[model samples]
Target chain A: MNILAMFKPNRDAKHYPGFGAVGVLFFTFLYLPILVIIAYSFNSNRIVSVWQGFSWQWYASALQNEGLLNSLRVSLTVALFATLVATVIAVSAALVLERGQNVKHAKLSQGVVNLPLMLPEIVFAVAILILFSQLGIQSGMLKLILAHSAFCIPFAFLPIRARLQGMDNNLEQAAQDLYATPLVTFRRITLPLIAPGIFAGSMLSFVISMDDFITSNIVSGGGATTLPVYIFSLVKQGVSPELNAISTLIMVASLLIATPCWLIAKRSR
Target chain B: MKKLSWNFWGLLPAYLVMSLLMVLPLLIIFYVSFMTSDAYGGYKAIFSLQSYSQIFYTADWDDNLVLNFQYLKIIARTLFLSGATAVICLLVSFPVAYYISRQSNNMKTFLLYLVTLPFWVSMVVRVYACVLILSNDGVLESGLRFFGLIGDIDSLLYNNAAMMVGMVYTYIPLMILPIYASIEKLDTRLIEAASDLYSCRMNTLRSIILPLCKPGIVAGFILVLVPCLGTVLEPMLLGGGKTMMLGNLIQNQFGVARNWSFGASLTVLLLCIVLLFLMFQAHRTSKLRELS
Candidate 1:
């Protein structure tokens, strides 16, 4: 404002054709590859490298790959189960942690909850591998659920904790004074208020579980493979159009979940 | 008032579950790292100083452990790249965020959603897109050649630079969200007040706006740095498999090497470094809050 007030208005926006060109280029560079991946999914040629006209055969073939489809199903199933389990633990932990009076211990509890996230994915993967092996627990769907659920709790807790921090205790106290049971008061007051944070946390946990390769790769035995591991293995073999097709599917799935949340967050703000 | 005791008991299930699932397993990892290797190096009950000693005593661990320095170099490089990413995101997103924040209801929401559109997509898929474009016959490589900007086909898929590109792409949303939050919190009148004082755009930005936004900047830095430290997979896939980054090494120990103890130490070391970074970040954020 001060600079504009002291001088004549300068509409330099038109003067430099290439002034913001760098940013435009940056956006294009960042986005163009993603656009190409979507575009080339229709490539009639088997080569991911060259465009030899367009067709949807790859998608049809990708869908027909039972092994790939099975893993995708497994990933989604595990992610869904993990999210629900994590949500319950996290919301409860967040409530108790927040409602409690001991600030020091609450912080410690927060630290412990976030511990799984801070540890390298490798360490957790190894720890679980050894722990499970020693227990003689066979690797299967159950093992993945157990392993993923361990990490998901913290993801569930962190956002809800943030929401919990901002909450006033008075509302709950008022409910208590009015003779409502603790359970009823919680449902009527705390849950509704913290619903958004729970939603955010669930979304985060689902994404983390769905995209997880390291822990799932390590802990789960040969029987189960997630989408990421499948994609990684196929990529190592070289980028088959099948892999490209799967990538497109994953891209679409993630985008589908993310777009709505983005809109909700933006609109709320 | 109802006693707080019963309510406090509600915390036990989560607390016990996390401690057993998380903390105890860590303890076991540290313990197993000390267990002696069997006759075939497969199974043993005997404790050996071998694993710990080998990391420093001889080439057995020296080769892999020394790789830490190389990976540390990569870690430093990754952090630098993330820092550059953070700075780039901050600069580019700030004005746009400011303008959006200043806009009327629906347009602002619609445009902000536009900014977040790509984030909705799986980051892995987007990263794979980068691979597709950078590969030998990928679009960008041929695009560059087609434009006559290069004489030969260039393959840019696997390298630290490409790794940085992936890291930046993954984290830009992180950087943006905080800056947007900070920008959103600023009162409209502050700009008007600065204008009343005849403050120039550059001066107001330097003295007033930037200072107020320091907390957000610090928060964004922590968010980026924490992930950058563990980003071995991105460099592995995107940088080409030749890059032996720390996360990859830690991953390999459990995967191929089967060395649990050494991996645990390396993980603990990384954990400590992140904790230190976060401590500094928290201090900066609190101080900035006090200043503004």
Candidate 2:
């Protein structure tokens, strides 16, 4: 009986009562609100809650808004700079911590780098806001870029570190046996091997920097707004179809960027 | 020696940025929390414990001090709501994760992808999606009225219950993914062996699976709990500014109230709570590691 059961289990073995129903309900709960947003984005009515008929008018209006455009510009600039700074430092940190066996305080350094991820984002935002103001840093864009880059480091660093750890040590050893210099070996072998991880990390941080609201909202000081901060301000006056149209656009754009990141991260794993 | 120096140079920039930008700022906040707030949203640089004391006491109209319950109530409400979110997420996530882990290889990948896809969508957008559904004459209201469930078109938004729905909606994926990861690693053969030995399913699950997946449940709980605690957008948007959370209270201190010192103190309190949770998680994880 044990041998037979080992080869083939009963039909109900994996089935937990009510699990299937709960799973189905869980997915519905997850997707229903998203679907409602997408549907309402096309509503012809001015008010977001009431649906009159299908129309693209809100999209047209959203595109023409100067404040929205400027916010998008600020968001893109911040994400670009933050992602660049974060990815470079992340690669350096990953290389050192993963391979430097004798590096002192390596565990402590890793913990410090990851502290932002563990704490509340509002705490960090409040801290950075105080830091910037105390130093009398007046440029809103500069404040945002600096703060976002600091927070994005761990998101970018973790994947690269994982990639480095998973790599076979023998390949580098074999290259060294062939008398290849450290820089040459790193450029030719190590860089290419972890390029996917670097890309994945960059993409992840870019999405994170763009999606940030609380930090940007607080740090921006209402001077240079990001897209999220802009959308949030609009919501204060109540939801509008124009806001819906802008939201749908932002969702689609993030999806377009994030899908490739997810695919690469999965495939590399 | 030269090679080690080169490695140290490579690591310095990363380490310096985190310390100077992130860690140093937190330290400054710690220092600033004890200072006094000036009239112009600036600091006085004078030592005071008034910021901390203000959390528990307030001056009455008679110029006598009284035990204040306002901030304490907000803190309690924040803890209650965040704790409830974690519990609800775990209950829903466990079954869903188990179901996903049991699927065929392709189905598992597809389901996991679906689970993670919403995470990419901006959180503000997702919260707004809740507003679209819960507001008066909204999609849910419209649908309900069509079914003749109610007469008047009243908004279901701007309450703690509505905010809870929004919180669960946004943070549920965080809960699901961690549990799925741990459940995916579970040894199915052990489960089959238990059943083969005449053990009932519930007994096997309770004894074997639950203990094995405890790490995941704990991880999922913390993952959901942390963000839910600090959430500002949900309370403001879904709760319609009526229900104030810790995040909202902090924002007000900085924004409208202009109490930089007080905000710093509140932030310090929040930081301590987060650190406590993280330390507890670390302890449990190490204990679990020693066991296995």
Candidate 3:
């Protein structure tokens, strides 16, 4: 039966039309919702469902909204701090894991660095919440920054580690042979080579921290609420055109942050 | 080897952060899971096995345990939904990924970028957009009405079907990327050779393409399945809180229910299941890599 089926003429043969149609449909499914959100952001109607006419009222309101602006400030501060801390830690850890002489512990450290990527975000949030409560630590912006940086480590580490692995060590060796100090060799030879990866990693981590919700929701206090948490609370209330406007702005910010990193990654590849 | 190297000391900052924030919290959750719940919404310090037992059997008023499957049902439902989402994503993404892979270099990059573009948008907003599209008088309903398929605006939100649509939509890119990566690396000569030998497309795909793409299929399946298992936002928004998945249950325990110990136990159970699945996937992929 298997042999007969194999030898049978393929009805679904290498037909480009069918495959192309599926591709078109898949892309449509992917983008239609996003496009709808962007389009609705301009709707003059207070209700998102009704399209009265094109208007910039929502955008203007979102821009002037104090709460939204405050959350955006909180989110930006957290993302920047987390990205900075995570990138530094990631670079140091990647250096040890990739370029160090200690081979046995490298695998252990590598696993630890990547562990958060595999764990569910909820578990991470819940665990951190539990730990903080048990330790009498308060949930606030500081705690949120700490948690975000922890979560962002894996994202930052991955690209930096990959760059370190691909790097040629001969230049550093040659620098050392030229009587340059280890710090000097690192400054002149190693840092410049891995700068792009570090930059990309930082950008990626920044965007992730900015976009994160679950951990922020669990860890952020009343005054420390981030944009996603605010959006989530608004969503719980009901759908509004204001959400559409704010989401569009967020989407623009993320694209601006992510596109350069994506281009850098593509070029590096 | 036990002694720290000079370079190893450089890893101290990361190690400290992970230990404090990641590893310590995980350990604390494990500890809390074994403790008893307090009257108020917190856990008592005393060790007890009550939370784990409550997952399967509940104590009756007569001091006898009765078989309870409410939590079990939620877990099973979660598993079923995750499995279905993985399967649907696999089916839809495979052909799309293949199509993208077969495109020209510039076209391939553009298509891949389009697939990943949605990911840059906030997931909460994307899910909300889905709500708008699937709501009564929403795009799907209006489109159906326009075609005379339905006489009235039908609400599709807050149903399993809507939840499934949202899950598949969110995760299809995850499924596509890995499969595309594998398929893109496939040698074109192999397909040409199979056709030259009078082999049908079925045989070529079956014997050549599928086997080569097994690793990717496995990766994509794991990627989609594991996250879907723990999805809370999608189910909450799309299922309208009518359906209780494991994620929602866990979230409830931590939030409204205030049963931290029980929530911790549920999280532990989920972690174990996810870890087991990941280990199995790792073993299978390693073996597959060796075979190929």
Candidate 4:
């Protein structure tokens, strides 16, 4: 009887009741708060807890708030510049690390490049703050860009490296064999193939730069507040439906931008 | 050698940026940790050991240096919270990851996408969502009231339990992804063979699955634990600024207290601990890779 039970082709064993229950419960836990924020954004009542009726007043208010608008503009500017710089640097670094087999201290170089991802953001923020002050560099948008790009290098490097690793070098070798110059082979063959990875890496860096708070908070000077630092200060004052509206809009914007990049990467894989 | 030179040229921009921005800044932090705080919210150029010694000693009423344990208590509390958050995330995420791995390919892709989608949202916004759900007359409380659970129950926000819930919620994905990667690569044939030999479900899991998943578990544990130690947003928002963790302490020193030297020392101490933990994790992971 025990053998029969054990060998009964336990294909349905994967659907064990306990596993299903936990999966359902955990997914609910993961998503409920986000749904609540989205729902509360449209609440007509001023009170966050109660849902009186649906309205779009908070969204209107958020749209018209000058401070919020300015912060959003600053965030967009920073993210764009940081993403551009970080992607270029990351691609170059990744190519060197992956393709340069004879390069000395490659492992150490790679570790140093990726160290920002491992270091605590608070510590990194404080370190940069001290360095900037000591070097007599004033904090502003330029400072924010330099810091964000430095931290974003690793995020952009990982995907690009993976893409390069998986790429068949035969195409580049074939191109070279056909008397194609190194630059031509790179521009024609390598660049086209790694385009998807570059897109994904840029998207990731952009999003990370947009979402940064601790680093931005510590380093930002007057008139250079990013959206997150602005939102944090507002939240410290009190929770309002306008904040909820802003949060929902940010979440939606992220999804719209990120979903396509993610899908492209998925399809490429 | 020519090819190597070309590669080095390619790497020059990134190397220069990292050395100037990341490495130099960290070195400055290490240097400042041994300096004295100036009255103007900056540090003196002269080196001293006062910051290091201040971690354990404080001046009493008679101006005598005495042993103090307030900072030590905060360190202990931070560790306890981080450890608990890691364990809870492990328990909650393992089953979820296992289930996801067992799904069809299409379902797995969709589910993994869903898991990662939340991570793009700002963490402050996520913590605020938790606050909305746990505060007085909030979603959870109101729902419980509707169900007639109790009368005049205390608000759930601004407490240690609330902080834990926030931490676990925020970091659960980090725990799940690593474990799911391992489970996805798992050999189901081993499970079938074990079952064919009359190994019970519990025995199969205990002897086969657990042993194989150790690397992922350790990786996930370290990933979650290390970040939890340095988190400031969750505790500050969820705990209502009533409780102080090491992250908050460091922030306070820099912000309100304006003791850059002390904050630098605290940051240095935290960095040392985190570096050691990461090195250990890397060693274990490399050892596991070798065995495999």
Candidate 5:
């Protein structure tokens, strides 16, 4: 839009706001709702109507809530188990994928792995629901774990693959020339080198599985509702100060969990 | 002894796992989409074009069939919403990313973490918070009324606006990270050179930075748009299920309506559309690079 003006102009960096006025407004729009949400969390109103006053009562209630805690427990466990499986698959796949040959077919494998990412979570969830039902594997912790792992593997693979592709190829070659067995080389040399990617990818998978609602909704089978499903039921069933408190508690919980990953991705960079 | 291909003999564990676990379920969807519906609920093994035809044509059923144009409209809306959201996300994230990129290293990392924090929270919770904020008699409605900004009440929770808000919330970070990475990679000397040559700042920006950043913009656009397009939960939970997206329509067909073929068709069509968008984006980047 500003392609023609560089030929003659005094520097007016301050006068011309770098992004223009539209940009500031955009940031405001992007941020205002979040600030409002944070503020409203303390509203004394049990209902979502206008706030009367502020109090810590909602946070207090959220802390005491057992149902929310149980749901969180389920979600965390699912995320943990799913990430464990996904990390193993992803790290191995990354090793195989980073071998720097069969590039065309390798791309196909990537596409196949990423297919779940492209498909709607609801559709994936629905498909898994149908598949599990047909196979007579009733929905439970096991199904949730497997379903989440299936979806999480791709995310886990991409970063690990990225790091493997970006790293110095000489290390592996040098280890091979040293008479180290491939397995031993991988365990000693490659794994240590790519550990950061593994950690980041695993964390990413864990967060994704934790946040997943659609697939969890489909496969939940009324017996093992995750926190997201619990929140959905809350919104549909009723609204109260309790739900608000729960939302606040979630904010705190995610903030707590995400902090470490955030720091890792930060300091390592 | 030889070049071991990535997918060679040693990697059977991965190939077997994904092929069996992830690949099999989708293959099941493919088959289920082809089978004919049964008398009571499930499908029979009869090879029939009846379900596929019924999605577009009405001759498959006795009397209760409805024209499937509604599904098309829903798909259109989904595309429109996703596109609009992606464009808006780009506009919003671009400057923020640029400004953040120009900051010191510590500030940049801090800003990046801040950008990522909201995203780590559950999508369901975020949508629920949006619903809380926008529901009738909710914070927004009464806030407006309390200040006498509007004399009457209006609901925001179940509208397209709410859906966009939810979409933007989830995807703004996706948009920002790519653009920021690209911006971080930008050569500052070019900007200084343009300044040294007394080139107008806007001209330098238009001629240099934007073109250089095209790849990242396209990447960010796709990262934001694709998943947002297929969102069903956001529409359902935040938009109150009042408006239907293609994802919702497809889900309804498979779940409630027992029209697997139609849903599969919808899903396939949407995937094609996504592919087209990505191709178009890639073409634009290549063209822009050529011009520059």
Candidate 6:
């Protein structure tokens, strides 16, 4: 049977009017903005909307821009370190919470862990600014690293926890029954099983750390600036083909990183 | 204390970081909000209520406070924008989500993936795209002119309508995903059963689908509304900083105004609104559990 035949046919399935049209429109609404930037990035005209001819000069200029490159370096450094720290912390916490045994205050701990996901980004930004200045922590790079990792822990922790919960307990138990120690069992059995989760979690945190604008903008404080902060300042100066080129490049990079994690998550489910 | 497992100690690093960074900082904001701002753009440690009081009343040259509606107006605009965005997202996403839920399995997966794809892109980049499209002689204006929708029009940027469009575009996915999750779990048999009982499409949707998907709708509403309230990019890029939302208002105090105490107070107020919504959601969840 075909996919449609896989489910029982319903008479009312086609009754909803305008839904199909709306779905098509929704996809267009989602993607058209990105397409506009990508298209204009290739335009040779200085005017962003008018297309004279296709050229790569915009990309060439963007690549050579020293300030943009510095910000990109800072963003990459922050994302890399933040992802590593967040994933390790997340995996450790997930192991304790999802170990198939009742842990004390698990609910409360989980709530606290997820609180960052709920609170407004502005609140975290201003609060972290206050925290750092009051504590006299003047390193902008250090502030970005700590603040990014703190919020990113929840993003990393969630997937790892979900993976742990979905794991089969029998494999670990069998290893233990075969005279494996807890450490051996974890290394030989549990760790391998949750590796995909760890990978997914790390990618997610990396994206979040990189995507953060407000927090980084607030806390970077005259020391270092990330790509988003840099982009915001450039945007305030007004739009240019160079801005379009840089934005398109960032969009492409984000997609390239996120798609693999998405495929893994889809497959695991 | 009971003997804790060795494995439990693994949680220490995360807990310590969270406590120091997330929890402590928020508490500091609360404390700093009650302090007085010194002339140097920093706070004095003296306890004062000037920050909180400034929200409703401003001290005039004569030192007598007049009732201030400026910040209150910003708060009202923020609420209206966020509320309108949530409702529009609901109306727009519900049908799309329902359509996806009714698709074949492979089709469903692909469509859902498409919906989530935009979220991976940087938010600043996405908002910048709005600038490219809506500015003078931008794609939107050019497209309109091509279709002869108008004789001449200036840039459509820097307006509340543009801001709303940008917000709905950004957040519609959040609404779609949760609503799809709930709708996917819904038994298709019920819809068939309703039809078998001669219920019309409108009644079946109203009486059956709507009630069943209420949880998803609520979840989507909170997800959309909260971010919209704290949004800074859309207002900055699309609203052209002419319109001030709560997020921009808070950022201003920290940026140009240098009143850290007042900024902290505004943040505290935003935090209270967020907490109230979360508490309401928790109460709803417990009630849902009891019902089920």
| Separate DockQ for every predicted complex | 0.38, 0.67, 0.53, 0.68, 0.42, 0.67
List ranges where model 2 is wrong by over 4 Å.
A1-10, B146-154
Question: What is the alpha-carbon lDDT of model 6 when measured against the actual structure?
Answer: 0.89
- What does candidate 6's lDDT look like per residue over B1-292, in tens digits? 2225654677788789889998999999999999998767889999999999999999999999999999999999999999999999999999999999878999998898899888888899888887878888887888898898867855588988899988998889999999999998899889888888888888999999999999999999999999999999999889998888999899989888999999999999999998899899989999999999
**Model 4 lDDT per residue over A1-269, tens place:** 99788656555433344776799999999899999989999999999877899999999999999999999999999999999999999999998898776888898889888989788888988889888888787748988998999999999999899899988799988998999998898899999999988988999999999999889988898569999999988888777889999999989998998799779988888
Residue-level error in angstroms, candidate 5, position A86: 0.6
Cα misplacement distance, residue A217 of candidate 1 (Å): 2.4
When sorted by lDDT, best at the front, the candidate numbers are: 6, 4, 2, 3, 5, 1
- Per-residue alpha-carbon lDDT of model 2 for B1-292, expressed as tens digits? 8668866977898889988888899999999889988878978999999899888899889978899999999899899999998999998999999999888998998888888888788888888888878888887888888898877746688988888999999999999988998888899888888888888889988998988888889999999999988989999999888789999899888888999888989999998888899899999989978987
Query: Global lDDT of each model?
Result: 0.71, 0.88, 0.86, 0.88, 0.76, 0.89
After TM-score superposition, what is the CA distance of residue B240 in candidate 1 from its true location, in Å?
1.7
- Where does the lowest 10-residue lDDT sum fall in candidate 2 chain B? B148-157
Candidate 6 chain B, run of 10 with poorest lDDT: B1-10
Using all chains and alpha carbons, the TM-scores for the candidates as numbered come to: 0.83, 0.96, 0.94, 0.96, 0.86, 0.96
Show model 4 residue runs off by greater than 4 Å. Answer: A1-15, B145-153
- Model 3 C-alpha lDDT per residue in residues A1-269, reported as the tens digit of each score: 99998666555444334677888999889889888889989999987777899999999999999988898899999999999999999988887777767456676878888878899888999999877777777648888888999999998999998888887899988998999987797789989999999998888888889888878887888479898888888877767889889888988887887688778888988
- Per-residue lDDT tens digits of candidate 3, residues B153-203? 467888888989989987789999999999988887888888788887778
The sequence of per-residue lDDT tens digits that candidate 4 reaches over residues B83-187 is 999999999888899999988899999999989988898888888888878878888988888888857867788888898999998888999999999887789
Clash count of each predicted structure = 3, 0, 0, 0, 3, 0
Question: After aligning candidate 5 to the native by TM-score, how far in Å is the CA of B40 from where it should be?
Answer: 4.5
Per-candidate RMSD, Å: 4.8, 3.4, 4.3, 2.9, 4.6, 3.0
| Per-residue alpha-carbon lDDT of candidate 6 for residues A204-257, written as tens digits (9 for 90 to 100) | 999999999989988897569999999999998888999999998998898898
**Shift of residue B117 alpha carbon in model 3, Å:** 1.8
Stretch of 10 with least lDDT, candidate 3 chain B: B1-10
Off by over 4 Å in 5: A1-32, A49-56, A63-66, A99-104, A165-178, B1-10, B57-68, B146-151, B192-199, B279-292
Measured over the true interface residues after superposition, the C-alpha RMSD of each candidate is 4.0, 1.3, 2.0, 1.2, 3.2, 1.5
**lDDT score at residue B96, model 4, on the 0-100 scale:** 91
* Candidate 6 Cα deviation (angstroms), residue B216: 0.7
CAPRI docking class of candidate 5: acceptable
